[model samples]
Target: MSILLIILTIILPPLAVFLQHGLGKDFLINVLLTALGWLPGVIHAFYVNKR
Candidate 1:
């Protein structure tokens, strides 16, 4: 992943997911994960970005 993705994923996981995959299930999941906890969001963002 790029530096920007890493930074975004860390700072705003939902935003990072949205950037990579747009508005969809992954984005929604990321938003939910983010609401649940920062770490889960970050992990999900990274996982989504990696794919």
Candidate 2:
């Protein structure tokens, strides 16, 4: 599940964030980051590692 989230993050950051954390700050952040730059979005989306 986590691996899929990470992969989704790389492809579509906002969707990945939504899947992991639902519709909240992270989703907003992902959208902003995706607008700013694709790489940043990916990084932020995968920032939440289940550690």
What is the per-residue lDDT of model 2 for residues 1-48, given as tens digits with 9 covering 90 to 100? 567776777888898778778898878988999999999988877775
**How would you encode candidate 1's per-residue C-alpha lDDT over 5-27 as one tens digit per residue?**
89988999999988889999999
Q: Rate the local accuracy (lDDT) of all candidates.
A: 0.92, 0.79
Clashes per model (N, Cα, C within 3 A): 0, 0
For every model shown, what is its TM-score relative to the native structure?
Answer: 0.95, 0.82
RMSD (CA, Å), each prediction: 0.6, 1.8
Which one wins on lDDT? 1
Clash count in backbone of candidate 2: 0
- lDDT of candidate 2 at residue 39, scale 0 to 100: 94
**Residue 33's lDDT in candidate 1:** 88
Candidate 1 TM-score, C-alpha based: 0.95
